[model samples]
Target: VSDSGLGFSHNRFIALIVSIAFLVVLFEGASELGGGMIKAQVEQTTSKFHPEKNAEDRLKPAMVLATEANIDNSVEETSEAVAAEWSAEGSCQQVIEGNDMLQFNLKEMVVSANCKEVTVTLKHTGAMPANVMGHNWVLTNNTDFMPVAQAGGAAGIENNYVPVGDQRVLAATTIIGGGQETSVTFSIDSLVVGDDYTFFCSFPGHYAIMKGAFKVI
Candidate 1:
């Protein structure tokens, strides 16, 4: 009698497994009712245990389910900070205006490493002719600035007052006469963090007076 009862229990267990497998197949075959019933049962169990978790907890699935998802947010933040470190890489946008008196309104500009390309716009607010008081924006390492400016003066207005093919020239804008404006966009890959850079007007005799610091921070 005991053996017969054991055999009956084994048969029932096999039947239960077969029933579960069949239900899984039905759910996979697009049986919405079967799938919904399974989902409802699981949700009921989840709510019973996690009754305190509300809408706010549900909104941030990644944050709330970090353990379940096995994600590390600290690493993400660190990567972002490293990317923004100006010394590693960066770019900037600067705007400077010149007047008939040969003066730049800004004495300094700052660039951040988050940018891949920087753009500079030079506006000639003065009404003077390019021959008399033309203005252009030029950038170079601070140490080479005086020499480049001297060479650029000789290079003349035809080259926008800048020495042509000068590798020291990080970026330069076109020479503009009064009431005209120009802009130049260049990569920041060559710029290093904390390096001293100087921006000046390469127009004849202007660099001596119109110059400022370019900060990469």
Candidate 2:
């Protein structure tokens, strides 16, 4: 099952990369096309009003394109900063993001076993309410993951879809909606290094896609 999940994650990652690349190509082409169209229109207007001047002399639309390019760069940088903030791992603190798409931004999380306590932050980046597209971070042994998740479903959203007072729940965060964030901290003393662990969402029908491997080293 773990292997299958890994395979699915890997394939999804590849698909996402490909889709992003395609989008980038389309966006660049559209930007260029738009700039060219605007420049041509400006040049035509200039030539029509002042035919004595050459086409090169009337082409003054480059400034607008330059400004647009600058704006694009700024937006790209801001996006990278947000992604960096959420992708943090490899320490005592881990950050993860989920959206209305029923997906987690990461397929694996790792922490150092030396840390006394570990913190996990879950950020919902979509535009949905908690009842519709709620997400939470749940940690359990690999063997207990599915069973706990199943029981959690019966426990309802009031319990963050986690089985109440269940020892199998190593850690879990409260369910959150779009634009909301929640976190949970658990002691690392109960965690064993090199053991099979898994993290998932306890939301009904979401565990299948919103799950990942958890590792301690």
What TM-score number comes out for model 1?
A: 0.58
lDDT of 1 at 163: 89
Instruction: List, residue by residue over 1-217, the lDDT tens digit for candidate 1.
Output: 2344555666677888899999898878776877888899999878845747675666667666874443245334543654455342333656678899777776666777666888889999999989998999999999989999999999988888788899998999988889999999988788997999999999878998789888776
TM-score for all models, in order of appearance:
0.58, 0.60
Model 1 segments beyond 4 Å from truth? 1-91
What is the number of residue pairs that collide in model 2? 0
